[model samples]
Target: MRGTDWLLLWTLSLLWGGSFLFVELALEALTPLTIVWARVALAALILGLALRLTGQGMPPRGLWPGLLVMGLLNNAIPFVLIVVAQTAITGALASVLNATTPIFTVIVAHLATRDERLSPAKLAGVGLGFAGVVVMMAAGRLEGAVPAMAACLAAALSYGFASVWGRRFRQAGLAPMATAFGQVVASTVLLAPIWLWVDRPWAMQAPGAVPVMAVLALAVLSTALAYLIYFRILARAGATAISLVTFLVPLSAAGLGWLVLGERLEPRHLLGLALILGGLALIDRARAARPA
Candidate 1:
């Protein structure tokens, strides 16, 4: 990866890592459905205006169908599932489950297509990184959380499919802004009815300023701008590299906990970081060896 790719990788990690915080706050005032819907809807609106302001128009009509499927896979399914999972499992546990995205992506791509074959290096990397995540989170309350854990893993698998599916946008020559905009639009279209029926957002009491701001941050920072960076990186880095952000999100969350909330830095966290980095290096080496 280039320096810019690394920059965007870390930026995405921070943005998505922060989403757990926003989800927590938003949940105080909204249902998971409402939160998920608002996020993509607002992001779509913002990106739409940004596209117009930047003098770029919508992507070709032919691209909308694929983009809609991308939205359903990438944004709608995982977003809702993860949010619901958080209601049942701790966020750290959810992160650990979420870290499986690249593993799923690698395997899914390997089995479903021709190019992204699974290698020994990838197996080792996934094993090591997954182990690190387990240690970092020290998650043991699994007996009662099986359903939630499964839900989170389902979300990761959905993300895996989304990563592979999103590759076409590069071939289509769609701008990242347009791709991001289209994705959120489709997510909103698909989820709006569910949100309205389940949440009836209008009848709910007004959320305080804090929750409102949290939703805004979730939409603007994580959903909207993050997807812009997401597609840009995906276009350059491919599915495996982009999916590796799953591993970083947890690490970034731990870092934020240490820095912002003064959570103590344990040795296990450092060990986990080392393992994940080692795994990434192996993955990178494998990527370098593959024929492009």
Candidate 2:
């Protein structure tokens, strides 16, 4: 990766890492569904205007179905699960569990694709990754937080599926920006009814200024800007290099959680994080060694 790519990668990590913090703050005044809906809706509006400014048209009709599925897998499901999980766990712990995304991605790819089948190193990585989960689960169990921890892992699994599913957009020659826009648009559409039904914002009290600001920052900085930088890094450095951002996200989230939220992880949580990152390193190293 170039210096610019490195800088973008770090920025992307912070943006995404900060999402957990934003969601935690937003939950002070908003329901999970409402927060998720607002996030996709606001991000869709921003990305739509960006497309218009760039003179890029909407995606083809044939792509809408795939985009909707991408929205469901990548945005709607995971966003809700993470937010709900955050209701029971700290943003730092959630970020650490979210780091298991690549581990799930490797397993999903191995099961779903012919060419991306698991190698020996990848198998070891999978084992270590799950071991990390077990350790984390033990930590959570002590706190009666097992369900929340499981929810975070499930969200990571959804992200893993989305990563594989999104390859179709690339194969079909869609621009990353267009794919991102279509995705958030679809997510907004999908979440609107659920948000209305469950949240019934019409009857609810207005959120405070801080939660509103957190929601806005979550949408703009975390979702919109982060997606832009993510694709930029993916395009410039390729998937393997871009995956390195996963290693940085937890660190950023942990630091921000401690500094801003006064959140701290237990020793077991730290041990779990170490194991998970070690697993990711093995998986990434194996991928890097593969013939292009």
Worst 10 residues of 2 by lDDT: 136-145
Please give the lDDT score at residue 188 for candidate 2: 95
Give all TM-scores, in the order shown: 0.83, 0.97
lDDT of 2 at 76: 96
**Candidates' C-alpha lDDT:** 0.79, 0.93
The predictions' CA RMSDs to the true structure, in order, are 3.4, 1.2
Instruction: Give a tens-digit lDDT track for model 1, residues 142-259.
Output: 6646667678879988999997898899788888788878988999999998888888888988988887898999999988788778877888988667867866887776666456
Off by over 4 Å in 2: 142-144
Error in Å for residue 3 of model 2: 2.5
Global local distance difference test of model 2: 0.93
